[model samples]
Each structure stands twice: as C-alpha cells, then as structure tokens.
Target: PPLFRRYQVNVLVDHSESKGAPVVYEDHPTYNNLIGRIEHIAQMGALVTDFNLIKPGALHRANGGYLILDARQLLLQPYAWDGLKRALRSREVRIESLSQVLSLVSTVSLEPEPIPLDVKVVLIGERLLYYLLYQLDPDFGELFKVEADFNEEIPRTPENNLLYARLIGTIARKEGLRPFDRGAVARVIEHSARMADDAEKLSIHLLSTADLLREADYWAGVAGNGVVTADDVQRAIDAQIHRADRLRELVQEEIKRGTILIDTTGERVGQVNGLSVIQLGNFAFGRPNRITARVRLGKGEVVDIEREVELGGPIHSKGVLILSGFLGARYAAERPLSLSASLVFEQSYSGVEGDSASLAELCALLSSLAEVPIRQSLAVTGSVNQHGEVQAIGGVNEKIEGFFDVCKTRGLTGEQGVIIPATNVQHLMLRQDVIEAVKAGQFHIYPVQTVDQGIELLTGIPAGERDEEGNFPEGSINQLVEARLIELAEKQRAFAAPRKEAGGEEEEIKEEEGGDERTE
Candidate 1:
C-alpha cells in the first residue's frame, strides 16, 4: 500500500516483538472487515499454520511482492533462520510446507534453480532482533538489509513543550473543561520527562498517557473549573493510586513484615548502601532509596561488592565514581585502616548495583559509624562524589514517589519524607496531588547538596562540625570509609571499563543510515 499522504506522525512504541508472536486475528466483525483482515494477514508471506483451512499456496500467491516475518516467530520455528538464510543466499524465495522444510537437497540441490525474488522481507520486531543477528550470524550482512528505528519520545524544549501544551489545551477544551495554567504545562513536561526516561521521546506509554489524559478530564469536570490546574494533575495521580488494589496490598504487607522501616529514631555504627531506580512512568518505580555500609576505619573502604556478589548493571559506572570520590577525599593520608563493617539496604534488593544508590550507601555507612541517626521515615536516593557533592540521579520522580507509596501504605507517620540530590530539585515534578500532600505535611521531600547535607537531613543531626584537619570529627563512618577507600585506591588501580588503556579493544558500533542497513 502506498504511504498515506499528509497523515499525522504515528509512532510505534511497541516492545512486545521481543517476546511473542504478533496478533494475527485482529478485531473484525463485519464481512468487509473480515475480508480486509484476512488479506492483510496473508500479505505477511508466512506459511499458513492451518493449511487445511487455506487454499494451496495462498501466502506465496498473495505476498509475492513483499515478505513479512515475525522476528521471534521465525527464530523460534525450527530451521527457520537457516531456511531464510538459504533463500537470501540463493536470491530465491520459497514458502515450504512442514514436510518439505527439512528435505534440503531434494528440494534444491547443487546450485539448481535460484528462485528469482525481488522480495522485501519485513521483520516486524524490536531492535534487539537485528542486533542479535548482526553479532552471531556470519552471513547476516547479506540478508534483509534495512532498519527502521522509531522515536519513543519527542524533544522537550520550550518550543515543542508549547506545542504539547496546545495539545493538552485541545484535550481540555474537547472535554468542555478549562485550559491549563502555564505552570501546569511545565509540570506536564517534567512529568513527560519522568514518563519517557528523560529521553527525547516521552515514553509514558500511550496507554498510560491516555489514562492520564482521561483522569485529567475527570479532575477538570470535578473541579468545575474551565482549566486544569496543576492541582487537577495531583487529583488524577491520587485517583490512580486509589485504584491500585495490588499495590495497596503489597505496601501493607511490607509494613506488616517490617520491611518498610520508618523515621530514624537514632543512628547506628558502620553501615551504608543506597540505590535508585526509575520507572517506565508514573509510579513506575517505587521511590528510589539509599543503602548504607559502615566500616570502623579499616577492613577496606573500597567495597567491590559487585565483584564479590557478581552484581552488574548499567548503573555501576556511577557507583564507582562515588566510591572513588570518598576514597580520595577522606583517605588521602594513606593511613593503615582496619575496621569491621556491615552494609545493607535501607529498603532494597538482594541483587543490586546501580550508581544512584552509592550516595545512599555512603550516607548509611557514615551515619552508622558516626553514631548520627538518619531519619527513619526519610529515604534518600542519588549518586555522590568523593568531594561529597551530590550528583543528579535518574528516575528521581519515580524514586521519590516509590518511597512515598511505601510510606503511605505503611500508614504515613508525620515524619515520612524523601531526600533527593540537591542537583535533582530542578527535575522535581511531583504529582499535583503529591505536592499538595507535602504541603499538608502528609509527606515531605528534602534536597541535599552533599552527602553531608543529605545525612544531616536524613538523621535530623547537623553533619557535625568538621575539624581543622577536615574529618567527620574522627571515628565517624565517613572518615573510616574515606580512609579505606584511599588504602584500596593505592593498592589497586581499578580498571573502570573495557578500554585500550586497560588492555581491552574498543567495541565498534555501526548504526544503519536511513532505512538502509549497512553490514559491517
């Protein structure tokens, strides 16, 4: 079919292709619909599953010009990849029956007849499909050399934000409601960032976005206002939360199990660990929190827990930065350090390694040994530096909200709060409802400029006065970990990544230009 001229841009934000078969029997009730559906499904050039129902050689007869194959489906089918490879290699196309699938030589021997095919093979799938083929298949470069990458989000700059604002306005007006305030538009963009993984494409999945839009409509109607204020956005969030039956149960369970700890009564010694995670969208990930590890001035400040625990993730890079920073700043004296230590989640996973948690971990460690109690109800999430400065962490909204949900479920004590990196304050787009809750003292969010500041905020204690020598009043977990980090840094030159400097060759990534896949 020719491309629809002047059609609005349609983004396909589907990832289901990585796992299962494409839905073939789509919605259709009328005879016209049935005919159209059948024809379209047939044009996919697939071997019909139920041969008894279809006419002989129907797919071959129909999709002669184009070939459509599900990447996963074809891969799962026995000998499918080989058969497709053979067809492309021979410059021929064949739709073999189940029985004829394995009869290789008799079907086509020694350069017999090449099925001349000007076929366009379309693999309806995820980017991973093509990526896997490029890596493992030697002859992949020869077949189906085309690619189509879709945008998952759009630019969130002021200009496009205004356009998005207009779209929101249109929705408001269509529902016979009021327009949105300018602040509301900015809030939406911030929410869009949280929705889209801060990507250029706002990835709050279409379904989620549609749901939000609908709820926004309801709020506007309820408020009896002509425009949707930031308040209405809050209302929609609260309404959505109220609908989450399972989440409600899970939070209660965590509370009953004492897994959701609250307000810091006081600080312990020698423990710290922190982690942060982002959701695909709203309440996607529960609020990110910190882990703490405490060391008694020795026993190695360098916690290569991942190497020990075999934890690996994309976020490890940030963790190393935090660890290294602590070592350089506190242990610069290269003093011999030996201190017993223990580090665990304030609220976390058994298998974890995401850099954002490093700050939390450091804080926990600092608080424990420093004997400074961290706030029990306050959860912190971010990455930190050796200099103790806070760095922006991803998924700030989801993380904050995640903790909020847990606290809410546990029966929000007035002290319930979330602590985030000072740098991440700009990213704050708490649901209008959540913001209101904060205002009502039902929840709280605190931003910290440094690990010290975060710790101070967490434990309700001033981070303690630094001495002339610049230490955490000695005997503190911060001082101990820093000392250990310095010792470890001196003893080992940590190889951060696979680079030539570390004796590893660089990986070359070749991206396809336009729709033409250039094989390397």
Candidate 2:
C-alpha cells in the first residue's frame, strides 16, 4: 500500500537515448494526445488502473523542449485548445480522462500528478487564423506572443538568385534526386519567379519547388540522362499543367465551338474583350469575356447589370462606381452628365469578382459614347481609377495566356494582343509558346499607363488632349465622346422645356380665372 512503488514509474518519453532536448511535432493534436491520457484494465467486470498506465502526451514529451502543432488541426479537435492553454497558463501538464472531464463517470478514478512544464509551443497556420486567435481568444496574445512571419517570395536579385540556386542544389541532394545542371537550375529559378507571379522575385514555396525537382529527376531518368536538364524541368512543368488543365481545355473548346462568344478578330462598337482568370486548386488559367456598353439620354446613371442582379462582388461594384466618377470628372465637368449607360459581361452566368475588368468596361463605355469601334482582336485587363490611370492586377500572366490561347486556337491574326497595366509588365513570365508568338510578331502584349493610351490603342484613333479653351481636338475619340455627351444634355434640356412652358401657361390661366371670380 506504499505510495512510492517500484513498478509504478512509467517512461512515456525516453530522452536518455537521445542527445538533446526533444523537438516534437504532433501531426494530430487531439485533447488526449496533447495533454496525455490515463489507461485502465478491466478485471472481473471492474476497471483497475495505476501510475504505470499513465501515458505522456505531446506536451509531456516536449517538456523542457519545443512542441510544434498545426493551429487548424489543434482547433479542430475538441477540448484540445483549452487543455493546451491550461497547460501553458499553469506551467504544468495535467492528465485526466475524457469521461471524468465530462462528469460522465460515477466511479472513482486515479488522477496523475501534474508534471512541471517548460517548453515552447509553435503553431503553424495561415495568417487569418493567427489574426482570428488574436482577436477572438484573449489568452492567445499572452501565451503565443512572438510571431514569425515568413515571406512567400524573395527578391530575384543576382545574389539571391545564386543563393536560390544553392538552395535548389541542397534540396536535390537532400531528396537524393539527380544533380541539376546550371541550365536546369536557371530554368527552376525562372519557374520560381513565375510561381511568385513576379519577374523580379522568386517564390520560396519549398514544397512546390521540391516537388518540381523530384518530377524533373523522374523525367531525367526517363530520358536516360545523367543529370537533370532545363528540358527536364520544363517537361515537369508541362506535365503538371497537362494533369490539371482539363477544365481549361474544355473552356477553350467551348470558345472554339462558338458556345462562348469571344471574338479574336474584326471590330465592334461598345464591345471589348475582357480577360479573367479562373483558379482551380493549384492551377489557374485565363478566359476572355466580352464586355459591352450601351448609352442613352438619362439622369447621369451608369448601371452595372452584374451588380443590379447581385452577381458581382463589392470590389466589382466599387470599380463600376469608379468608372462613373471618372466619366463625371473628365467629360461632364462643365455640364450635367445627361447620359445613362448600362455595362454588362455578355454570356456570363456565374458570379463576377475583382476590379481588373474596370479598364475594359471603361473602354467599352468610351467606345459607346464616341461611337468609335473597339478592335475585337485585343483583350484587356487592369483596374482603372477615377483619374483614368491604369492599375496593376493579379494573375497578369494567366490573363495574357488565356487570351493568347483563345487567339491561337482561332489561328493567330497578326493583330491579336492583350492590353495590361504598365506596372504589370514586370509580372509577365509567360509560357514559352506565348513568348515565341510575341517574338515572332504573331501576337502582342501592350502595356498601357492611362485610359487614353488604351482607348487609342483599341480604337486606332487619337485620345485627344484638352486645349486651353477646354475643347478636345476636332476629330479625336475624346472630342466625339464630348460632342455626344453635349448633344445628349441639350436634348434632355429640350425635352424638359415643354413641360416647364405648359406649367407656366396653366398657372397664368388660373391667376386670370381667380381675378374674374373676385370681380363677380
């Protein structure tokens, strides 16, 4: 009956066999797994337990060391977060049965003595979770105070490129893959920049980079090569696309089959091609949508059809509002905006998001107002501000490639191209085929800084600058738009004048009749 027994000591974690403090990563951090658990033996229809059955959890094993956990997984497990917090706050690990914690057991149970805890707990999760915990959980700030944020990418400078090449070499060696030659390393670095979506930065996503290396090694072996080459790396990349591009192929097929109405040639008034990216899991590709605008005389309202029907997101609505501001600030500054315009993405049934199509929408509206046809061969992507300055957007490369694939499918006209924000030119790490088409003058990528430049490029007419007299050039796109707006305003005034005159006549007649009645 003595408390100190010879057979009672349980060695849950043995550090005597190791050299340093233990670093434990609990992939599944359940409540029992995190704070230890007690086991019992059923003898003669009764449960008997002892200290020897007490098993240590991650916290117990990582005591006086470090414990790494996934924040999402830890939160997903019931009572796991509370137990971990209790251990951290009290500076000790306590073991208890789930039934006892829930008060479901009526029988007496053994409680293990609390173990002294001195360990660092690290949680790996998305930035959103960290912020959510900081805002929602009061104990989070006090417990996990230090935060280490790792950048998804690093600058692709000459020095960093060498370092990245070394990193690639290290990973290849660690993974026991074939050694990559200099060209292959260069290709990988370029691909990293592409993954980062910036030509000036390389992605630091190690898992993706490592996977690419492994796949490249497999390709090298298949090709009977001793070392991985640039071709092997490119093959690996192509294989990845081939595996995930089923949806993209189907979309392109739809476009080619005339099921989707995207024009690669000709000219149309008030219509332009707008590029959008569709992201499916790890794969993203671009598709072109036709944006069109119609204008009439009204009380200065620009209706976004997508927003009216609740198919557009807030950002898209904001972009449409910005277009109204731009129109008023530019064309209607000296007069009331008497034009009502409706903008829509033709054949779009799904919800639309992002402001990247703002520039395209504006161009279409301008074309409608000016009655100048926009070239259907050119696709557009970028966000435009009230000042008409083109702003950069994400997935620039995909947008361009998406349009290019569509154009190439229809047999590339030499006039086919894409208009993107000037700032987004730095993000153009396009596919080799697209690049080759550009180099061969079969396709084009136009980087525009302002709406005027883009409209001029699309319409093949001058986007006229205003003179000191506040008049646009006689035969320019701006002049035409201004003239049309003035005409609409004048017509609106003329239409309102008759009602005013009729009201004035009625009031005079009533006044005369009142005088006659007073005389009687």
Using Cα atoms with residue i matched to residue i, what is each candidate's TM-score against the true structure? 0.60, 0.96
Tell me the deviation in Å of residue 71 in model 1: 2.4
User: Which residue ranges in model 1 land beyond 4 Å of their true spot?
Assistant: 1-69, 94-98, 104-115, 158-193, 197-201, 207-248, 256-260, 264-283, 287-294, 297-325, 346-349, 385-389, 405-416, 439-444, 459-520
What does candidate 1's lDDT look like per residue over 1-520, in tens digits?
2344235342212333434333232121122211111111253685322212222121222223454667776676565567656655665545443344446435331222223544456667688888998888878766767678876677667677777777777765675655678766666666677666553445434566556766776787787867667777767766776665455456546655767654333344433223355333344455333455655444445554554455545466456545655745465545543444454555544456567776767766665555555555667777777777888877787677666766665566678777778777766766555788798998888888877787766665555545887766555445544545555444444333334454432222222242245442
**Candidates' lDDT values, in order?**
0.57, 0.95
Tens-place lDDT digits, model 2, residues 108-225? 8778788899999999999999999999999999999899988999999999999999999999989999999999999999999999999999999999999999999999999999
Error of 2 at 190 (Å): 1.2
What would you estimate as the lDDT of candidate 1? 0.57
Could you tell me how far off, in angstroms, the CA of residue 461 lies in candidate 2 after the best superposition? 1.0
* Model 2 stretches astray by more than 4 angstroms: 1-8, 509-520
